[model samples]
Target: MNETVNQPTYKRQRFLLSFVHQINGSVSVTDLQKLVFLHMMSEDSNYYEFIPCKYGPYSFQLKEDLDILQRGGFVTLDYVQGSERIKATGDFPTGYFFRIPTERGKALMRRAYREYPYYSINSEITDRFFQGEELEQFNRGKQTYAQTEQVLFTIGYEGKSIEAFINTLIQNNVRLLCDVRKNPISRKFGFSKGKLKHIAQTVGIRYVHIPDLGIDSDKRRSLATLDDYKHLFEDYEKTLPSKKRFLDEILMLLQQNTRIALMCFELESNMCHRHVIRDYLVRTNQVRSVDI
Candidate 1:
């Protein structure tokens, strides 16, 4: 039985929709955690505990939850070779894949948005998502300031193609790449601070490594307790003011002409501290994240 069945209908809807969106292709567990959290935040700004998945103790029952979504026909899971090579043959090798709802999912979401109008999250001006000229101005001018505008926003990273993902930001001419990894050196590509810095520089993007944005393992341990995990999570929430200060110090370095992206190992923002930082920026600086 799907334990998520007992969760409020909106919570389930938010989780499944975000999960399906992230799994449109291959995705790592870390990526899923981030995506789910972002969705929850968009639905409700105060919502910050993670979905019940393997990333953390509270979200450890991933198999069961995924099973529920699978049974509902909301998603399909398969293990493939993990990569694909395309050619004129038109036949591709088998690889890991998570087939997610396309048009049908969007249609359902539209209906849900109507039926559960109260389920919609209304973030304060500081929590609004960024779009259009606001984003353009932020990236184009140095130190140019805009009053904070509250707009609904969500962070999503896991998707079909990595090159496609990178291209989105490049096409937008995003200028700065903020490396929020504590170590800045990873065993993987696109994460190690050095490699990412070089790549972003080559693409005309400035890369800045901010150790403060890295998840504090000690702090995380403090957040996990036997008694439901909510207490510790809330404790972490209280520290945001300091975190915001640190992030602002970093942002202050931007010369009004910079567009910044906080990068970490997790593909989704929710699973990582970057989302919290993103929230702080939106609420405090009027800066918002767009899907790029």
Candidate 2:
């Protein structure tokens, strides 16, 4: 270990390090994702949340942390098998971090596929491990997120993980997430505009930032009750009629997309300005609205 390893650590980073060390000092990227996914699925004590990716369940946050450890000299990377040609430029081959699994990693992969069938929905290799009921269950879970209906949804990301928030969109079959914040940003991981957009589209949900529909940040600073929100929204509602052009755009998108979601930052629709927008669409365009 280096002096950098002596520095105080983030809990999640420590968890990742411990996980990698438990299996050995290293693991291939895919198997590590699967292992972490299985651990999270167990006992409901999740240390990280994952989104489905090309191979299966994946966590970008975990990948970033691994890079942090490698840079701190707490870990090393080396290419395995076919990945040898894809070396990192002027560095210790970060490509090595994405290698084929070791024998231990392979065992973990087999275990994860058997235990967490849902996470294996998009698996590149786990398909060979299943047949009969296991295969049917996996196929069923794969289609769980596929819904097609013309329902309008309103959702907020407060007090939820990115995984939870995205899961809502996926579960409701929301095709587009219309962000209704004046400032499309958040301190939360995967909730800021760029990251949120990337995460949404990664899971087949489109994202759009409709900042024109946002309440001013200065206005949202001190709302303490439903009455306060009501008072603010009464005035806020007056401005919507004048912003009809943007509302028209939203209506157009909803019509074209089949299913869309309005998103802001509060957990409850009653506490957020998005409810006002949802109501406006409901009353004027006859858009079906569901607070999620």
Candidate 3:
């Protein structure tokens, strides 16, 4: 006869494998961290203690558990590059991390689900979390902004193809594309102001360049650390109050188009100045912004 595993050990393994399985057997480690954090928050489970880290919530215990699982042959780790082919790019732009489950992992998760159906509650929570609080607020805000109005959307084009970028805008029903760059030129082929505008027109979206709302290239070029970005954005924020004219213009555009997306080059919003602009608009105009 096979030895029975302890309940606590089984539970932890089940939860981890089930979570990975629920996301189609493959998830970025960063995304898995966030999903688990959200799961803990929603279920009030004390499975892990998460602290606010550089990339949202993180848990050392969770990391350790994943390591143990990998060592035991429960899962496999793979590193992938982003779909973009930009040469001489750093890890942030060029590298992608993923966790994939082994056959053993899938079998364990299936057994756990079959034995304890209650664990399936996490699937619902995962779906809702992906919908995002900002998206929820945007849906609510539409009633007040205008019948046809939608929330402001922000996106980064650092590691995406032009097709992917354009599809994202269309999927979100964006009516305007606001280029929040001090200089609207990029070595990335389709992102330069002229090329970007032409593509947006082809898809029936209006494009505008808002250089005044952008951070200077000099300030952005040397951002090797998070502190550097923080300091740069802090200084950027100080200048915003004086740019009332530009802010008002943005508001006017929003009022007319209703669904506008701010475009930048950073993959993550927190690492970019576009988030600063979004927060400022939300703070002053009582409007919601969503990153798409």
Candidate 4:
């Protein structure tokens, strides 16, 4: 119950370092499980949350890690909340919390490094599976979390011109825009598929429209049996075969090129299939999403 009073033991430190190192940067809990699995193979402690920590578990969740990092002045969480369907939903904004080691944290790492010399080990291990940008991604993940303030913006086509939106997307260096609307066409003037695609291409953004990913209106209505959107999401997850297909295609696209944004009608991802897509990506692949 009282974590700080115990201080971090050497066993805890070693396990933590190994867990953090395995993550390599930002990670979701599912990916964290895989990393833990690799580190604690054939060990009963591997499922510590379901079992015991002494044997292995090293179970880490983003919120818990974030809390520890925040206490250490290492990382801060930032998110935007948007109102949709009379409810407020949270979404990730521009970059996530800046992840860096604090001075004290760095001192701890240095001492650990002196003892284990994992950097050299990692250099060799990384050389086997990565190069260039991939290597950078792998290395950047090793830093301890750091907190920083984040700015949140609301989504609206309102007073802004579509050209301006396109320009803003370009400025963000968005590489691929995966349109997840069941129907990519916008009845509203200037938001139609032809115009959006033309504009996106003209600005050097690759656009691929996937319609099957949209929320089924009938299904949503039927599922109105549930009051909470989270429950709706759970039902959607259970019934939607297309969502799984969408994820498979997205993963294939990732293998082709990692940069991509899941686009949908609701500009805020939390209210759309994009949120599900984003969650699946981060949970399964450790990919980051930034709302544009």
Candidate 5:
């Protein structure tokens, strides 16, 4: 027997599948619900309505839509057993995990992401729900995406120990360390290219040295004041267009790695050529910069 489904209901099912697919193929049921709730709160012309529930918000229709998708083979759900610790405490903590969509489901999601790219990114959706303290804490934790378009970060190690520097990278969940120094040598014991690479590798962080992105020692050593830095950056900016190969190499790296830290020696980003590199990336490549 063939059963008929309403257009609205069918659209919602596709939307749900697309949403799950957009968030890296799988998400915990709670996160999926929260993301949907947040999306509805953000967009006035959203598909779902919700009433308040014990866990912040509730949408029975959303659950029904998911079930419909599951029955039609658009999505699959698996029950993850509760942890032993929770069982010992006499409280079970089972989780519902959803798998990636089927081939047919993926086709629909690809179309959905194209139609709704703003809602496709996990960071974009999660950023809306985190508040002051929570936001700070979340930023301090590992970030989820590395190849996030138009996003970059810069860091200075002038006043930091290697341990502190690595900790900062880990805190921010930086996966790649881009050394924008012409000479990867430092007076600091642990900061030389070889040593730094070893340390980064020990902690599962990738290290890359891009000399073309750095200023020559003569220009760097000549800087004595803010005006000098300003002039140097101005001159450095002029050379960026000619360095297309290096710039493309960096863009490729960013595409491959999620979070990258542009490392240099100045304590403040304002005093270093790395900032100029960051600005160049942001201006030329249309990326955003976060100084961490």
Candidate 6:
């Protein structure tokens, strides 16, 4: 939990590098991703979560973690057969691989595709990894999860890895994400604007950030009690009229897209300003908002 020259600042980052260490040899980035994806399934920790991607189960947050570890000199990476390769290096924390040994050799990747067909839905190489009956089975799993229901939603990423957060979005078939953060920046890996937008686009979800709909940072500083949050959001409600155009724009998005979620930093909808916006939309348009 503490920052250091030899340690990854977050548990998730450590676990990621631990997988690289488990390999004991350089692993292709693609294979490392599949390995970690498979590992996350076996481990109960929400330290890392994943979304189905072009290369099967992928975690944008994990990618960011590797980048950070690289910058910190705890890992090494290079191009391998047109894909990036990863390996543990000097000062990398050793013996931290958490999960009991699962599968090894070729079975790991095969198991990843075979067992988790949903994750391999959009996989660019599913065909190569599986064939015949297996290929057909994989095909059956490729159905898109996006839905056509008119709903407003609120989701907070307080304790979730970005991968877990996006996984939730993909699972709920959320078509658009309305970010109600005033600054659209974060210490969290993928929630920051640029990274968040990239992840959204990768998963075919739209991202919209409306600073006007957010509670300013200065006012968010020392909320030590429920009464504090009450006053903070109460003041947030008063600013809605001045932010009417932004509210209408979000409403239009939900109207047009059918499934839109308001995103913010708190895990509980009650603790985030996005809930206030959700209330406003629901009261005005008679559309209910679900907390995700």
Best-performing candidate as measured by TM-score: 6
Query: Per-model C-alpha lDDT, please?
Result: 0.45, 0.75, 0.65, 0.46, 0.63, 0.80
Error of 5 at 251 (Å): 1.1
Name the runs in model 6 displaced over 4 angstroms. Answer: 1-18, 43-47, 90-93, 96-108, 131-133
Ranking by lDDT: 6, 2, 3, 5, 4, 1
214-269 per-residue lDDT for model 2 (tens digits): 98899988988878888999999999889999988889989999899999999989
lDDT value, candidate 2, whole model:
0.75
Worst window of 10 by summed lDDT in candidate 3? 85-94
C-alpha-based local distance difference test score of model 3: 0.65
Prediction RMSDs, each to the true structure: 16.0, 5.5, 15.3, 19.5, 19.4, 3.7
Task: Name the candidate, 2 or 3, with the larger lDDT value.
Answer: 2
lDDT for 250 in candidate 2 is 87
Model 4 error, position 40 (Å): 61
Off by over 4 Å in 2: 1-8, 82-111, 122-137
**How many residue pairs clash in model 1?**
19
- What is the TM-score (0 to 1) of candidate 5? 0.49
Q: What is the lDDT of residue 57 in candidate 2?
A: 74
lDDT of 1 by residue, 1-292 (tens): 2434433134544444354444444454434434444444455632233311112211222333555555654445555466221111112222323343233322433332333322222111211333476534423432222223322232233432223334444545555666666677765434456655654554456767778656556655554444534454355567777776666765664435355566665565655566666766677677646633
Clashes of each: 19, 0, 0, 10, 3, 0
Instruction: Give the per-residue lDDT digits (tens) of candidate 5, residues 1-292.
Output: 1145322235655566556655643555655655676565556535665432223333555766776666655556766563110001111122323343333323433333333332233233334444576555544432442334444679988877675677677656677899989999998746999988977775568999999888889877666788998998888888988987988887787778867889998888988878877887787777767998
Cand. 2 TM to true fold: 0.83
Per-residue CA lDDT of model 4 for 122-213, tens digit only, reads 23244344558755664564332111222111133433446445545544445566776666676643456776676566545677777776
TM-score of 6: 0.84
